[model samples]
Target: MRYKNLIFDADHTLINYTADERDALKRIFEEIGLKFSDKMLDRCCYLSEFTWTETGLYDVKNERIQREYHNLYKTHLDLLFTRIFTEFPCSFSPIRAGELLLKYLKDGTNSISHAEETIKKLKTEKGYNIYIATNGLIDIQVGRLKRFAPYLDGLFISEELKEIKPNPLFFKKILERLNCTVKECLMIGDSLLSDIAGADGVGMDSCWFNPKSKENQSGTKPRYEIKDLTDLLQIL
Candidate 1:
């Protein structure tokens, strides 16, 4: 095998985050006594993505800028309800709504297709050290990834590291903690901006998990690309 360590992104790579988000959103609406509809969910998703993009969450070019934007975005949780419930005539405060959303999101445990089986095979048969490197909230991610605990060697979360992906420091910290060289590891993820670019920035090999065959408009490229988790067996 060319790589000894396999670093995976949580959302979309190994977990069905979209499904989790949709389910959590519906539950939150119900808890808050608000009617939920698919259109409302779509609007919320759109606004959330737009907000993250506009806040430089995906495009920060340097560690300094990344850190600054990350800190500023923390308050986004408090304002999320304001952005999504503008026309809903809700009485719940943004802070309360944010709390409810996080509560439900933390309970979500949806996994991607073949995620556990592939991870198990890689760990047991291939003898690779598997770890999850995610930029998601620590509490939510921890709860969501409970099913993969037996297979994972460790988890590197941005909240705990005080750094986000695309920043060299984030990947460097993981390498330092793992006591491994960059060349010995392979980063596998769905995001071109975060996972691929971050690994590339740190001189590490990367495999883009593009299940949807999304167009790659970003300049940062991965060393390999796969459309499925099982494909990792052949590449590794």
Candidate 2:
């Protein structure tokens, strides 16, 4: 095999999180009196992850410095809230919804999902030493990593490292920890900008999981590509 070490993204790639996120956000809206409907909330939830890395719509804030993804995410959330406020037929409080949304995102643990049995296969069948490199929080990532994807060797989360993805330093940090050169590693993720671009920047190979046939517009290129998690077995 050309690739030996494998680095995976946490959400969407290894975990089925979009649906849980939407349901949590919807619950928050209803709790706060904002009235998150089944259809509208679902649309926003689906759109957020679908367009996540490519669409530039995410509010991923960091204590160090804000990133474009974070800015766009906030903008998208604001727009969603604005629409809910003005367009919704029911009366509600946006503040409460926002509170619920934050709490839900932080408190919900099982919200982290696995990509079917792919995680198990990667550990047992493939015998690939796997690790997660993501912009997720440390506590949440560690907790979820332990529960859903116990096969992982380690987790590199931005909140703990004080850095986010697509930055060469983030990848470099993992390389140092693993004592592996860039050539020995492969990054598998759903985002071109964060995961793929970051890995490529370090001269490391990457596999982009294009679930939505988004290659036409992503503009960023990866070392390899796959459409589904099951397809990953064929690549490795």
TM per prediction: 0.92, 0.75
How high is the lDDT of residue 130 in model 2?
81
**What lDDT tens digits, residue by residue, belong to model 1 across residues 182-216?**
99999999999889988999999999999999999
**Candidate 1: C-alpha RMSD after superposition:** 1.8
> Whose lDDT is greatest here?
1
Q: Tens digits of per-residue lDDT for model 2 on 1-236?
A: 66667888887776666655766776765565664557877666655555454444342323233354444544555555545566555455554454455556554444222364776787788887888898865655665556555677888887667567877888898999899899889999988877887788889999998878884465667878888777878878
Judge candidate 2 against the unseen true structure and give its global Cα lDDT, from 0 to 1.
0.69
Q: What lDDT score goes with residue 196 in model 1?
A: 93
List residue ranges in candidate 2 displaced over 4 A.
33-36, 43-96, 106-114, 143-146, 216-220
lDDT, residue 30, candidate 1? 86
